[model samples]
Target: MEADHEVAPPNLADIDVSAWRELETAATSPQSGFRFLNLCSVDSEARPQARMVVLRRADGPSRVLEFHTDSRSPKWRELSTKPHVTVLGFSTQTRLQFRLQGTVELHAPGSDQANAAWDKLSPWTRTTYTGGPPGDECGFEMIDEAVLPKPQDDAKGKPHFGLLIFRARTLDWFQLRRQGNRRALLTYDETGALAACRWVNP
Candidate 1:
């Protein structure tokens, strides 16, 4: 006996979203384009700290982006207090850049989303957060480590494992080409509605 499979028709609502997804994919391709964003976050004193982080996930239709970090890290605390953040992604291969400004929400340790993400993490990845707090000063040059407990079988589930969700409000896209530099600013209003999109010379 032969099995049959059916393909569903594409949804028209996904057209614009698909375009943005393509852009994200091209920007995050491992071989040519891996590191994209230089995420910037502010401390309690309003001091800015920028770091390079991999773009783990993106949902253009929902206008959401995901990035992971140590829960005990200072940046996590900063994000908890101040939810606003800025992410800058540059593709050296295409000389294209994307700047994202958004508000972030930290998922609780054992929340459904957090649990799902933890399940997907490899044992090596889980070991990093096995220690106490991330940024706590141990006052030691280096210390030998022990075997980390598995997430599922361990008595204490991944303590400091968490996920950050950024709800993007505006996206600034720039393209650099040999012929003419181009840039575009796509802004969303405070009401969560896409406001105006315009092109400018880079």
Candidate 2:
């Protein structure tokens, strides 16, 4: 008689911790495909609004994430009134979906965070915030050339630039699979450290 040997299944703990670390790494890496996420905020009427935003920073130990935006944008008003926001992201390569719920703190033009972020922007990128407030109606007769900033000048956009700092309270991580799905809910303590992580039905 001969005995057969079978391969062991992959470890769950390694997958869980690696998943969290990958998310942070992706957000912080400029070239990463997962560097963008959908930021969801609520309007005064309680309707949900979502938009794509580039992830500027991610700090795992601090449970923080950041993005840049124009102070005149409608999202600024929405976030200012509500503070709390929901962020959704997915990586097609890894088949992972990350849902985060957090409160945002806005840094205005004069604030250090805003100023620092502004200083890092390239001149071409600075032109993005040079125009009038977002969603403003423009007369059809005005030619397209009139609305765009000239290549020579973009300094005026500085004041309109702002930074959004998000303090994540909880993160819901999910990975899809044919055999079985894995999901975990991670909660952060008052000091921003990971307080608890528990697997939930996917």
Candidate 3:
């Protein structure tokens, strides 16, 4: 029999389910701690580059994730050169951290994936891609304009808008707690099937 005041510890299966559920929630919820991921990639100079990217999509069954990016950004070029990346996110509320290693697939302009992602963007988000190239100097006066998501304006941004699809090869999940910490590693096969799951020391 269990003690009345004792709490139940989650098993491996429960932890796996919870991790995926949190990821799915993070993709849709703005207030989610995991909504913003720190994406790291290697640059041409063999140095690591890190940037914060929004979590646009999460599919647990397929072990896939997606994020939108400007096609002209340096990260885009770097990722194009080396498709491998590390994505990290954490939730203070839950004390859970997710670190994912994966290869990214870029969907260029007019591609089916990019088109679908672009259509889902709100008018305000669509305006982000209308500006000058990312990381470019403001050579001219930066005037403020209420850029509405007009068809033409949206068209200008379309060429710079692209989608990055991440297929996870492994996931490292960790939970921090006062009493004790827990960690687990989940690996996926080439076909996106979960190949193995095991708990590790935190």
Clashing pairs in 2: none
- Local distance difference test, candidate 1: 0.70
CA lDDT, candidate 3, residue 117: 91
Q: Which candidate comes out best when scored by TM-score?
A: 3
- RMSD to true structure for each model, in Å: 9.3, 4.4, 3.0
Task: For candidate 3, write residues 72-106 as lDDT tens digits.
Answer: 99999999999999999989999999999999999
Query: How close to the true structure is residue 153 of candidate 2, measured as C-alpha lDDT?
Result: 76
Candidate 3: count the clashes. Answer: 0
- Candidate 2's TM-score reads 0.85
Which lDDT tens digits does candidate 1 get at residues 3-110? 222333234233335436754574356553534467799999999988876667776666777777778888888999989999887767667677879899899788
Expressed as tens digits, the lDDT of each residue in 43-141 for candidate 2 is: 999999999999878877787888999999989999999999998888887888889898999999878888888888888888988877888997777
Residue ranges of candidate 2 with Cα displaced over 4 Å: 1-17, 28-31, 139-148
Query: Which ranges of candidate 1 are over 4 A from the true structure?
Result: 1-19, 22-29, 32-36, 138-157, 189-193
Better of 2 and 3 by TM-score: 3
Q: Give the alpha-carbon lDDT of every model.
A: 0.70, 0.82, 0.87
Ranking by lDDT: 3, 2, 1
Of 1 and 3, the candidate ranking higher by lDDT: 3
The TM-score that candidate 1 achieves is 0.76
Candidate 1 pairs with clashing backbones: none
